[model samples]
Target: MDFYQTDPTLENYWRGVILFGRNVASYKFALAHALYEVDKSGSDLVTLEDLAVPFSRHLCQHLLHAPKQITSRGSQYLETCVQFNNGEITQDKLIETTVRLGFSNVIDAFHNVNAGEIEKRFFLDERKTAKGIRLTDNFFQLSERPQYQNLVYETNARWNLVEQAWAMGVSRNLVTVEFDEQEQLLFSHINARRVNITSCRDSLNGYQKGRCFYCFRTISLIPGDSELADVDHFIPWMARNEVNNINGVWNLVLACQCCNRGEAGKFAHLPSRKLLQRLHARNEYFVQSKLPLHETIVNQTGNQTTQRKDFLEKNWQAAKNNRLFHTWEPKAEGEATF
Candidate 1:
């Protein structure tokens, strides 16, 4: 997230930032309104995603420019759509049609129009190429399941093009672990951390299914917040507990806000503590981010406590070595990974 934090006053310096996403939100809202109109007018023919294209192009324009927009050149309707929408379109439309049509019934008509109509009406006389088609197809695949993990991963993979820097962003918004000299292994009790018990049940269940691993009480992402659902160490921080060897990951397990707090400082589940050790030793080390929530830290590999200092390290070199981001989704029958 901090990767592009240049001075906000850098004089349209944001011209180069990859932030068409912000404008896309507006376009999506416009599309939604259009869809609502279509439904009310007895024409539920077009779907929400179809209405998203024109505004998506409009989004590309804010970021890329007119000549560079994805629809600049094309042989087919969808292919033409991609020509102007692919991440390269610049904010060149001195005056965007869609922007002018803000909150208008025509925009609603755009939202209600199907891809076939739009393409046939606006994208005639274009040569559709496989390259452009693939690009457009990729976007749809991603919108299907916008898992933050999958999005972040694919973004790093395709966009990184060089050094993968996922560890930082992950910690900033998703999941992370820390260790630093300034804070000599400072640990907090499982109770110290605050969380929304009713979190993102959708994402949590997607990861942990039913039944809490700790209490087996059908845990879920505490609803409301989008924070990581960490498998915590229920015992004291700094690994102080020794009875039943409670400091390990095996003792740790899935815990909701009530269980984590209701028994804060107090021992809850043996598995909660042990699970961290096991998960830690497994390939579950939290990758610290480059964006500084705190100081510098590295992601732990499967084993670090047993290894010699400096020899064991935590860096995103392997995970992000030559990162790539792909919007993953099942293809229509047999599409290949681009």
Candidate 2:
């Protein structure tokens, strides 16, 4: 699915960066967190040294929890941050190292997605003038968005999911993502121990681009919000015996409450063919992301794109043939988002 085509809002572009941008290391996420922090200060121009403080601090904080930040072997900048975390290096020295190494690639590549640059540029690179990067109006405007805090939570959650996948060293075929209904979290078994990865809503919202799966309305990560997102199984979980891995990421989408279980919600009912097509596109987004969900979905569904599509189609056909689920569509269908 074309993310920009459905809703080309600034918030959607930012979510694209966090959700779909390739992660050789987690520098993108740290840079994102740092960008939000710097924006909160109401500063337009930030020196590399200033940005490094939060950038390195976030990496240091996460390093304490998950040591493997990169898919590659090692990162000198990360090593410096590790030293600082271990009290083996001064903060000043850590900042200096970060200014030199941390911004080497993330700044240049931050706006890139799907092999092209996004139309909206959040920050302008100004290192050639020795002034560091300058935040654009787009950056500030995004901070004012109602879902700003949700974006922040989503970024951190995505970072945690990637880092956990990296640290665990689970083979692509062996990664199994389990949902905790009571806690509303996604986790996996590591050495027979449950390791909570992240909030299911936070992780899935990025792929959904913060919109409800059915109506395309903006959803919230915060609690007590009327538009708060619900983790709906695209294919109802009641068919667990008929389908394998009914609660897998392939069958999950974030929907607003009104479209999930309200009077017109799709409770235990089959969605329209158009919605099924959207679900296929949404699952393809997860596979293209190459995140932890990528492996889990591939394992649960199929590896090849056609094979995955066939899996969903087969399940959908079986449910329809059984005549057990009545078809349901939203009363007010918004623009197609997937």
Candidate 3:
């Protein structure tokens, strides 16, 4: 069975990640797109060498841009490949990293390789016709899944929006400005991250199947409902300086207005262990979504699951240490049974 179809919470978790998360190199999204395209003929088999051509082209066009003239170093790994565009790195290195990084990222994000410390025998799996691995049955099914398609669309759309916003801001900058104009432009785009909450809610509500992220209560998206939806910073926006990109999709969750503004809601408090588990499970669903969010989270936190959990735990401790404590009290009637 497609778990996303059966599990509303899992599905919503993915939507939250794809729509709201900050992406770096977009390896996860690129890999999925390539697989979906090559498998469009309905074959479960795919060639890594063949995939590299299209995947490389897509990343180069969309992601492998020059380092920011001032602020960002571009994506950490991809920037190494940017030297290829500037005639600095060898084509062989470019091709090698393209295939290796893409393959590793897909496996890392989806296979939970680090969880088991597997030997990566799967990457070397090959067939007579092509030097490539077969798609996992789970992934093969996901290639044809509509939810997966939505994930790709949302991930690319968000990247395009941020890129365009940055480009627009840069294009309008004046040479006379004394401040790092490009940095200013980048921050301007970053600031727009806050606006994504409302813009993404319509689709997020559908992905969440109209349930609040915290309380799991049925939330109203219908016109003129008294109990409207609210976009909550799951980690609380008040911790912005302490947490990186607090407004990004990873930290944002849909909540009922009550849970958002209630005395106990997000008032600089870390959630209970149960809620933290829900958040972790939700993030795991994002990995299964086979989109950039998976790689994004892995990159943001550590590569290992324990590391990611520890990272969240540290953030929670930081909140408590700073005295930002507000206990989340799920209402008896407000919580969903699931």
Candidate 4:
């Protein structure tokens, strides 16, 4: 329940994990075993809080046999929490209570963390709780209210890209530019707004409401809220080798920041037009149906995928010739009608 703050050295280590992998799921997958295993002299574990409930560091101590600092802090705290100079097994003894009690709360915490959108919903500072994420309370609470169920269902149907944009905005979002070795501090020569990237995103948002055309996560909540809507390339920029082609409007979607930064670029170079067409067609079908959109995706995925593919193919040559994913626009929502 109580803890020491992360010192500079350990703070850098955690930041490296955050910056490099760009998501907590990637970080957790990377940190699994070292977190639990015993070491010869000491372990690399440290106590921290669960995300929303930051004050509850020991909330999940049941998982750690003997939860203590893994990284270095000061001298006194280490002696009491870690190796006993007397060679007693207090370290192992404390952690054992969890294993002995049959409480799965601790391990389940780890699993819930790795479960996608569940992790990105809030801050993960451990002085809070050793737990790493915030659950979708707003999303769920809104969903349960019949008045908002339709909106919530539609929102959750496209949650992945939605969450991704929110994550990019909340975390480290990179702006791309062609720079010479002399260009330092990035902002010196970078015309971020003039790049007209926002205009591109706006165009898409003009159509899709700044929500991701793919997933519905809002893309611009975090600090500095770097253009949550990004100009995406339907084709890989590297593959095309043409700058003009890279920023074309036809090639773009005003998707949530997550789709722009994380999803589209990671697994595929650009999102398939077929996917968009499917998303659109499916959305239209859901709107007409008596059932919620979430249920629609679940029930009609196979058919939607096929029709979507067919629709995209019919427009395939035109979309490719026009270069569809090259630009982006902000999302439009509520009464702030753009």
Candidate 5:
């Protein structure tokens, strides 16, 4: 079953935009951050100049950390953002550049996911008529939800993951993303120094659509919450010596507490063949998203689809053959989400 369709709430639709929307550049995320900033003012209609302030501010802020925000090499607008961050340009000049060049695509593409427009509209683009966007009722309603702050955090987390991937050149370097069990974050080694990318829960939860990897139950990303998701290794981490890059994105998934460590939880047991197929599908979603994780997974797994499938099958067989590992299946499996 399609997880996003299960609920189809305004929040889910918003998640769809942030989680599943294409990311050629980080513009959508910047626009999303700007939307939230503007929404706080209780303003339904916002001018382009008003929106550009926060939009450019967010891009400049992120540029300081992850310099490479886009996959492509050149961006005039981003250059202006960099100048603004470097104190080379005034804030007014940065805003003017953003107002002219920034919204060229993100405004139209923000609602798009998986090659199509989402069912709900967060904002109505009025660039031609009013030179700005008018926040829709759906957008306002979503902002009022209790999960609003969490959604903002998720958006920033996703942005960091994508930008870090691009900045690190994961596709070329084949950076192995390792999980810090104690910190519950994903990190990679650069120049022999470890760099944390993002919270494992926030990075992977979006791909899972906030559902448990095995049971398909709704999961939370908030810390210290009883329902917070766990960062699970699809092929038990104990088998790291046997399988290459055990901490790779392909091997990581988010699971509910019950499914990760509770009674009858997966633990170190090898997932069932059915769940293995689901794992394959979930990894493929990562590849298809064309995010930074895409090339990392492709490099670690395989370049071709059949080759990747075979890679997983080989790992599954190897794990299954090990006397130390036993096959496992969730007691109460929900619908197939991947």
Candidate 6:
């Protein structure tokens, strides 16, 4: 099935970009936020200065992956701003670099629109000359359409989630992977700390009805049972050494020790399609609960239900493509109690 059937807004937004944008990194989301801000101010006009804060804020929120991780010197420009001084690169220097790069991406987007990249008339009503610019009627209708309310809701919802997560010092970080030049095989793992996932279990346990995420068996709370719980990284934690924060509730799930560590357990493997489906349903419960975790998931995956499913599917595919999709063996030995 096409993605639009499951998540119309997200699908449409992506479609808009594929049609109108230059494919610059994260430009779609950045552009979405920019449209939201201008619309909120009851204006269709936006200047370079008007976009600076939003663009900077969006770039600063996530640990971006360029050719390398954010900490790497040659990584994305915004990531550089988040780092401190180290000789030629300082926070101030990075900030200036980001501003220039961000403006360039925006200009490129406009150029794409003007060059008839979009099938519709224009992305902006007023042509962008040397000064500022105004958005087109088509742009507003696309952004503000009633059927697409989730687009705006999801955008703001994610921003709020990120703000809260950052305040609490929780990060949705990525691990970097390196490949050998000749063999084109992954290099050895780099040392990285495990993300603190214990912080989320109590609520997940409650939400899952105390069931293990993979096998659908109840997880025991008691001290000595084999059914005792473990917080598992749905996507194996070891696959990507550079991603340190795979412990977010979006990726963490309650699991029985057997499914977690038994001989047949899935270690660093991508789960079966069934488990992916189950995880998507499970995350929906969190979204329905409207808890802080809900915001986190929406922020990570787009607000639509399908987007979350798509995120897992894509990650699983990536792992498989990299020869990282180890097989998981799920064996059920009737539910045990403490």
lDDT values, one for every candidate: 0.27, 0.85, 0.52, 0.31, 0.82, 0.51
**Best prediction by lDDT:** 2
How many residue pairs clash per model?
Answer: 56, 0, 2, 41, 0, 5
lDDT of 2 by residue, 1-338 (tens): 27765778888899888888888889999999998888456568889998999999999999998999988888888999999988999999999999989899999999988888999999999998965999888988898988788998899988988888887785645567788877899998888999998899988887777788988887898988878889998878777777777777788889888889899889999888888989989888878777687888888788898999899999987877765888888855556666
lDDT of 1 at 287: 17
Report the lDDT tens digits of candidate 1 across residue range 1-338: 11112212111111111111122123333232232223223322343233444444443433332222121233222233344566334434312333333323323232122121222121111112211111132223323432322222222211221111131233343322232223222221123462221122221222222233333343433334433234544333333323233333222334444444543422332222233333333222111112211121232222343431221221111111222211111112211111
Highest TM-score among the candidates is held by which one? 2
The order by descending TM-score is 2, 5, 3, 6, 1, 4
**Model 5, which residues run further than 4 Å from truth?**
1-13, 40-43, 71-73, 88-93, 113-116, 144-149, 170-176, 189-193
Write down the worst ten-residue block by lDDT for model 4.
1-10
lDDT of 1 at 238: 30
Model 3 scores a C-alpha lDDT of: 0.52
Per-residue alpha-carbon lDDT of model 6 for 211-316, expressed as tens digits? 6777757565444555567777787776555333455566777788778887778777778877777778767755653424655567666679778888877776
* TM-score, prediction 1: 0.28
Candidate 1 residue-wise lDDT at 75: 24
Model 6 bad stretches (over 4 Å): 1-199, 223-226, 241-245, 332-338
On residues 189-251, what C-alpha lDDT tens digit does candidate 4 reach at each position? 122342211122222331233345555554442225554455444444543443333333223
Give the poorly placed runs of model 3, Cα more than 4 Å off. Answer: 5-198, 220-225, 332-338
Compute the lDDT for candidate 2: 0.85
Candidate 5 residue pairs in backbone clash: none
Candidate 2 — which pairs collide?
A: none
Mark the regions of model 1 whose C-alpha exceeds 4 Å error after superposition.
1-206, 220-231, 234-254, 263-298, 303-338
Of the candidates numbered 5 and 6, which has the greater TM-score value? Answer: 5
